[model samples]
Target: MAEEELKIEEGGKKGKLMIIIIAAVVIIAGGAAAFFFLGGSDDDMADVQAVEGQAGAAPSASTGSAKSGTALYVAMPRPFVLNVPGAGRDRLVEIKVQLMVRGSDSEELAKSHIPLIEGTLLQVFSSSNADDLVTEAGKIALREQSLRDVQAKMQEIAGADVVEEVLFTGFVMQ
Candidate 1:
């Protein structure tokens, strides 16, 4: 009976040891994962701060021309509304666009040409078909076309590609 008691005690000690090891592993893994994800966010925050600092420095560096290696974004004052041809009836489409430029000069240039840009965008939007706007590829194509037109116009006015990209902030079709 005494030998049997000793064996049972040994088995209990082994089971307890296994549970302790497993718990230790789980806790260490959780800590590692937390460290990995949380550490990444700090890096992201640092990157954002660096970019902001650069943007702030850009305007101070140059007045007439934009500083190299900086990005600027300007939003249009109003959305563009147009009627697109549909299967049976006309579909109304509204889009809000933002202009991505390289520097302060580009941003100012874009702002100065807002009216001309809006008119050009309206012409492009009006030419689009209702069915084409529904698909992802169609939306991308439309954006590309708009960007090309805007850049062309900007080149004519500013003698440079003031507008880098046309970003669609909002799009609705009904």
Candidate 2:
């Protein structure tokens, strides 16, 4: 009878150990899943950069002169960092934005509004979160908003149609 009790005790102990191991594995797996599915971190930045192509390669647009003017090339710097709650504190990133401005000379228009454009972009990007800058659709919306902001700022600063289209040269989430 003592031997039998010992056997049963051993079995019970083994069973408990097995349950503990299974529970540990499940917890580990659950943490991994949460880490992957939750998204928004340094890892997500890779996905963002991959989707965006080379920086500062904006296509030239025709600048209808008072008579006939040629288009010009312009390169603008995007916001540096976008702070978001999901990616730990504030995450820092560097971006370059390409733009095609239509005017007597695209270069001149782009140049004149560079400061205003930069400031507006910095303001907009500073306020944005990772969610706001995620996905192609989100980027498109951001571009449209940027165009409006730049054009409005140009009208205020240079009193002209300084920007035509806002293009993303470098877009990253992290």
TM-score, structure 2 vs. true? 0.52
RMSD of each: 5.5, 15.6
For every model shown, what is its TM-score relative to the native structure? Answer: 0.64, 0.52
Location of the lowest summed lDDT over 10 successive residues in candidate 2: 59-68
Write out the backbone clash pairs for model 1: none
**What digit string (tens of lDDT, one per residue) describes model 1 on residues 36-83?**
876767678899879877666444222333444468889999998888
lDDT for 82 (candidate 2): 53
Question: What Cα-based lDDT does every candidate model obtain?
Answer: 0.83, 0.66
Compose the digit string of candidate 2's lDDT tens values, residues 7-81. 999999999999999999999999999988886798678775654333322332332222123334478744455
**Predicted model with the maximum lDDT:** 1
Clashes of 2: 1
Sliding window of 10 residues with minimal summed lDDT for model 1: 57-66
